[model samples]
Target: MTSWRLSRNSVSELRPVLSYPFEAAPEHGELCEVAPGVYWLRMPLPLALDHINLYLLEDEDGWWIIDSGIALGPTEEIWEQIFANQLGDKPVKAVVATHWHPDHTGMAGWLCDRWQVPFYCTQGEYLTGLVYTRATSEHFGWTNEQHQIRAGRGQVGADAARKSMGGAGHITRSLPTSYRRLEEGTRLTINGQRWRVVVGSGHSPEHACLYGESLNVLISGDQVIPRITSNISVSGIEPEGNPLREWLQSHERFLQVLPDDVLVLPAHNLPFYGLHHRLRYLIEHHEDHLLALEEACSDIAQTAVELLPVLFKRELSDSQIGLALGECIAHLNYLYHRGQLERSVDDEGRYRYLAVDDTLPMRLRKRQHQADTELPVQV
Candidate 1:
């Protein structure tokens, strides 16, 4: 998913101030009550984002956990403390993964086995995670190298980039042998309150968000975050998927269905109130990026690598490059499918995008044609 970047200026212009009801996030291994019977748990992540927020709901007999932290020693230690100090004698009745990401589901298997609890998630996410964990180097590692090469990175660069891309699979532990599938609109009662499931895609396959009307809260997982735009990328596994379109459409549906005043408990950021404004901001942000990308492609065909600067204003680390590239391709593919741009693969196997509009000034058209011709043929 997308990384969090603080943009006070842009956010202020886009929407009104979002209320952060909590004065401070919970300390490690501790839980902060956000609503009645709902506790916020913050876990540390090794990544630049630094922390992931998980939720714990008090059930009649035990508790329900939403989004397991990554499978790491520190995370486990924190859980142990939570088990001993925070949860009292209550057991974890169920573990719900909002998506298949390691940060969200990495500890599912361990936690499930520890508590012997059922795993609840969508079928698509379960299967995807299963495949990802079982994937060999041939499937993930080699594929990444090839993808990098296709993006105009040479064989040497591809190999180096592959090393920086990290491990083959995201899951640190095996998933449960079986899972209870959570379909859209499914309803479950927890702690004497009814919560409905709302599913979305693009950031992850079948990402589940929980909306509790009685509690006036939404457990918005990665589907909606207060500070960061969730990463929506077309991965090598589904290169042709139009996730950007799915992401935008999901927000549209959320706007119609969700109430504006409900508190949003995101996977990463602090709990906030302003569901409608956040959805609109996410939609408009992507639309603006698409328009700018389309305009950039007007004069010449560009590969995803070539257009990175058009999308990101700052430099990216080696670890961030792969995700950036994937997101760039996703935006390009969205425009390509919508007839706003023409996509083509060069002899070297790299994909390039060109604007579709032909009504531009003759001088600009001639310059475009000349630029295209003068560009070196990769093959």
Candidate 2:
């Protein structure tokens, strides 16, 4: 149901060119060495985006895993094969999840229990995962109904959304009871090399990306991918939150601090060299969406549901509607928070957004200008 794939609006000729160093990905059960002592492992997901990239960081004593795939039987079996044949007989030292997504953390508990090692992730990611895994099973349907209804879905549409909520194969595994926190600037020494934790939000709270300075490599977990822009949504729990703003700000910060030439190992796509260019593409992609959405809202008040076609022109599956609606609300909330749009609620409780004026906000204008004119940064 989660549409983790790239949206229809993410593609444009203005997108920066990226260079893939690897011609092909390693097979599901095998591992490929991307850098010294850093191994890339691919796993299969049952979603539209069918694969996730996991990494292994070699330590003097043992190996550290970047992420654990979803807790399905086949995924567990894949781990078993890797343990038996691929690990070179080294014991796993620690299990680390880049964020709280099911695809990233579902098998974390199982791995920690098997290896008798500590589980590590940011506190926000760990706590949020507990909330979703513990609470969503029973309340997901009812909660989704209310959320969609408020976004202008009719009873039939809302019912369809409710039916598509939690069932089988949805984040079935719970996280370990405890975990070591990976915060911003946390440095970890592995195999005599240091990897620092770079945390970002919006995609998930405190999503952790690991940076190996000496290797000029980054294990970027869904924050910066080569092919697809990560799905940034305003959750049903926090309707007014400005996650799009947070998502954009996080990318802007990365462009400033991270080096341009880091070979990024993203969770979804292949490893590539173009950190800064890709970051700008992501920022501008959302900016273009915001401008189009603003213009669409100028003529008449529109509900989040009504604006879906403006962002995604392709047909959406029943499972994808929930994800699409949440993303729509995120863009609306971004403009609403910037005072470029005004929101109103009807007696039936449907929310509508209308633009305040034709003039673009100063901040939005400034960001567009910077993206167009700024030269390549050395940092």
Candidate 3:
């Protein structure tokens, strides 16, 4: 690997007087190989977003990679060290990205170009990722998904919202002009084993996952993680996100295919057992989200502003708060779909929610009804 700046002294080993919040670059020295023919790599990103995991797979052709690091200097430098030390003299035959997120697909284009290989992914993720520069998405709010959020001191007017997306475009590099679309169920070989493709949704469009039964391994992209719950955020582009529903179904799909002990290699966090338990946790988390928002909006007339806090579970700045809007819309939309929440646009053009009669999903409907009963007499 060429010498790059991402690799430097182990600054983490040095003691710190005090740790700053949201340090831009993550510590990159914490890489570990979880299994033979599979290596887990970490690279520094520019926020407290935590370290991103890039996977390397050994195949008969050479080294097959499931995602690339970001396109920043620190990340690039780390790749240089990686290629030199671990992949030295090895060829990268194919590059397959799990989704459109930059942290996972950032270095894909560069690696494909450098190694003269073809990049493959779902067409939607590819096209979206192609135009997905921080510059692009920032042009508008994260998407129409955000515009649907109502607020109490939360809604930034149209002008401020647009300003927030500024330079926020392109979360990841778009697919290069030269690439192949990976079709679901297509068989591929890696590390001398035949693997089948599985597609997951409600996270990114058409995210791809790989399962090798012989090795009892699943290369789960962002679909599942060990620690942090993956955000199934509603983007402006997909407003009618039944993500809560979609994600739960995805969990069932993920659980149905693999055996109990198939090792999981995720895009983030450490490898571990208990795939079913993790899926249950993710399902339960969203279930809580659905219930929490349902009850919060029941007590009073609520807008995106009112429910952002309950949904986000963290503080948001003037800009980042926009996601709260989409979150509100998602829950409201979910309830609306289930016939649990009534909705109508008021004079100012904001949608209001009221609980409705329902028997299905009784847990959510029951709380929503109580909140609805106590709601205001006036809109």
Q: Can you write out model 2's per-residue Cα lDDT over 124-234, one digit (the tens) per residue?
A: 999888877766335656556667778998788777755554532366576899999999999999999999999888888799999999999999999999878899997
Over 1-379, each residue of candidate 3 has an lDDT whose tens digit, in order, gives 1111111111211221221122232246434565667666677667666567677787766888788867665776777777777775778899988897878787787778788898888887887675545344345553442354333332446556555442423444444666787777888877678878888887777888888768777889899876666666665566566765676788888878767577777777666666776776577566666666655555455665656776665788765665566656666677779887777655565667765544334664454454445422210
Ranking by TM-score: 2, 1, 3
lDDT of 1 by residue, 246-353 (tens): 999999999998899999999987888878877877886787577657767877788888899877889988778878988988898898898888888798878778
Q: Comparing candidate 1 with candidate 2, which one achieves the higher lDDT?
A: 2
Highest TM-score scorer: 2
lDDT of each: 0.81, 0.83, 0.65
Of candidates 3 and 2, the better by TM-score: 2
Local error of candidate 2 at 355, Å? 0.8
Candidate 1: stretches off by over 4 Å: 1-16, 141-146, 160-171, 358-379
TM-scores, all models, native as reference: 0.88, 0.90, 0.80
Q: Number of clashing pairs, model 1?
A: 3
Candidate 2 root-mean-square deviation in Å = 5.4
Instruction: Output the better candidate (1/3) by lDDT.
Output: 1
